[model samples]
Target: MLWATVDVWPELEQAVLVEASASVRKIGQSLAVGAIAARADWVAGDATIDLDGLGPADLVSAAYVLDEIAPASLPKLVGGLWRLTADTLLVVEPGTPAGWQRILAVRSQLIEAGAHVSAPCPHEAPCPLVPPDWCHFSRRVARSRLHRLAKDADVPWEDEKFIYLAASRQPAPVRAARVIAPPKTGSGKAALKLCQPDGSAGERLLSKRDGEVFKSARRADWGDTLA
Candidate 1:
C-alpha cells in the first residue's frame, strides 16, 4: 500500500547506533524513533514521562508501539494512533547541523542493516514537501516568470494564488522568520517586522510612541537582515 514511516527526533544525530539498531530490528521496520517525544500524530498521553525531558527509551517505546499497532494512516493517527509500514521509512530530524548529523547516523544504521537509503537532492529532485506557493524571493520570481510564460502560451495555469504555475504544483509561502528582541530594562521598546519576499514590508511596535512607520522603513531597508 506504499507505506512510509517517519521517526522525528530533536537531536537525532547523537542517537546510539546500537540501541537504534536493536530497536529497529525488534520493531521490524527500517525506521525507528530517535529522540522524539511522540510519533507523528500519535500522542502517548502518558504523563509519566516529562515531555520536556525525552530520551532514547521513550523513543524506542514509541516506535515499538507505533510499528506494532500500525494505525490506518498518518492523518488517522492524528487522533493518537501510531501507524507505520515497511515500504518507506523516513527518519527525519530538525533542520540544523546537528539534525543533519542525526539523519546521517540513522542512514548509516539503515545501510548497515541492509536497507536501501536515499538522500535528498535539492538540485536534481527538490523535495515534494516544498510548496510552490512558498514566498521565497527566488521561488516567487520563478513562479512569476512561469505564470507569465504560461499566460502567453494559453495554458491553464491561471490562479489567483499564482502557485498553480509552479513546477512542483505546491503552494510555497515564505514564512517570516521570527526574531526575539532582547528583554527591555527600563522603558525600552521591542519591535517585530514582517517582510514579504517582494519589496513590501509591515511591522509591529510595542512601545508608547507610534513607531510603526519607522519599523516598516527599517524592515524594508534591512530586507536582507534575516536572510
Candidate 2:
C-alpha cells in the first residue's frame, strides 16, 4: 500500500527552507509549498494556505474563503496533503520532538474517532529543517524510538545531524557510518581511537588542528599525550 506523509505548519522562512531542503534530500522527496501569499506563480489555486502571515482577522477572512470553496474537504484535504498520496498517513513535526508528541496526541484522537492510525516513530537524526537551537522534550523520544525500530527492522540508520526517518513500512538496509567529532582546541592534545568488537584498532589522531572541524574523530585523541 502507498503511504502519505504530512509536515504540518512548516515555517516557510528562508532559514527554515535551507534546513528543510537538506532534510528532504536525505529522504529523496520533492519540495512543495503548503501555502502562499498574494497568489504567486509557484502557488496553486487549490494549494493549502498557510495562515501564519495573516492577522487574526485576515485568518478569519481566509477561512471563510476556504470554507466557501471546499467546506467538507478541509480536514481530509489537510490530512491528505500531509500523507502525500499515501494510503497510510504519517504526520511529521521535525523541529520539536515535543511537537511530535502533540501530533501523536492528535493522531490518537483521530484514531479514537475512527481514523486508522499507527504509533508515532521518533526521528533518530537531527531535523535539518529546524533551527539549531530548537530543542524539545521529544528529541530523545524520536531518537530512541527510531533507533530501536531501525535496529529491529535491520535497516541502517543514517547518522546525519537533524534528520529523522520514519516509514509506514520498514525500509531496506541502508548502512550508516558514524562521524566522531574531535574536542575543541585548548582541550589538550590526545589521540583518539575506536576498538571494534572484533579487536581491530580504528583511527588514531590529534583531536583538533586550528579552526578546521572534523566530523568523526578518535576518543583516545583527547586524553593526555605521552611524549
Candidate 3:
C-alpha cells in the first residue's frame, strides 16, 4: 500500500504514517511520496520506506484535493492520475453546484480517455441533468464537540453534500438506476427522482396499483440503486 500528498502538513503527514503502519506491519512494503518522503524515519518501525520509484497502483483516489489545485492545471493533474490508475480512479468533491461542475468536467475527461462510469451514473451518455439542476448526494455526518462549536450548531449531526465519480479502465458490471433525490411518499404512493440506465433523469410516480414496483419506490432512499 502507498500514500502520497503534495504537502508536508504535520498533522496530515502523521495521519498517513499512522494509517500506513498496519499495511507495513503485516505486508512489509510501503512507499511514501512527495514532500512527506523527507520525514521517512517516522514511518512504520523497521519497515523500509522507499522514497523513490513511484508506479501505477490498482486504485487511485483523490478526495477534496482538486479544489486546492489551479483550474488550468486540472487537465494535466487528472491525466497524470489516470495514467497511474491501473484499474479504477475515484474522485470526490464538495456537493455544491460548483463542485459538481468540476466533477462533471473530470467525468468528461475520463470518458474521453476510455474509462467507464461505475457508480452514481447508470450510463455513459452525457449527464442528463441540465443547468439549474445538477447531480449530487448527501451524507449524514456526526459532529464532534469542537466541530459543533466551530459551526455554532444546535444539532449533533449535519448533512454533508458531496459529488463523486468512480471510473474504471474496463467496463463495469451492469447496474440499476440510481435514485438522485429523496423519494416523496404520501397515501400509498411514491415519487422517485431517478437517473435511469437509458441515460435519462426524471421522476417516476408509483402507486399501490403497481404493487411491488410501488413498494420498491416507497422503500427507496436517496442514492439507492434500484432495479
Best by TM-score: 3
Tens-place lDDT per residue, model 2, 136-173, is 21222233667768667443444322211123322323
lDDT for each of the candidates?
0.31, 0.30, 0.76
Off by over 4 Å in 2: 1-86, 95-98, 119-227
Query: Tens digits of per-residue lDDT for model 1 on 1-227?
Result: 01211233343332222222344345533334442332332233332222323332222222222232223432233122111212334333333333333334443444444443222311111222222222221111233566668667454343221110011112223333322222222244545544333424334455546466434333432223332
Candidate 3 structure quality by residue, lDDT tens digits, 33-141: 4434334333342111231234665666777767866788788768877887788888899988888999999999999999999988999998999978988999898
> TM-score, each model?
0.22, 0.23, 0.76
- Order candidates by TM-score, high to low: 3, 2, 1
Count of steric clashes across candidates, in order: 13, 19, 0
lDDT, candidate 2, equals 0.30
Better of 1 and 3 by lDDT: 3
- Error (Å) of candidate 3 at residue 165 is 0.5
TM-score of 3: 0.76
Candidate 1 has its poorest 10 consecutive residues by lDDT at 161-170
Better of 2 and 3 by lDDT: 3
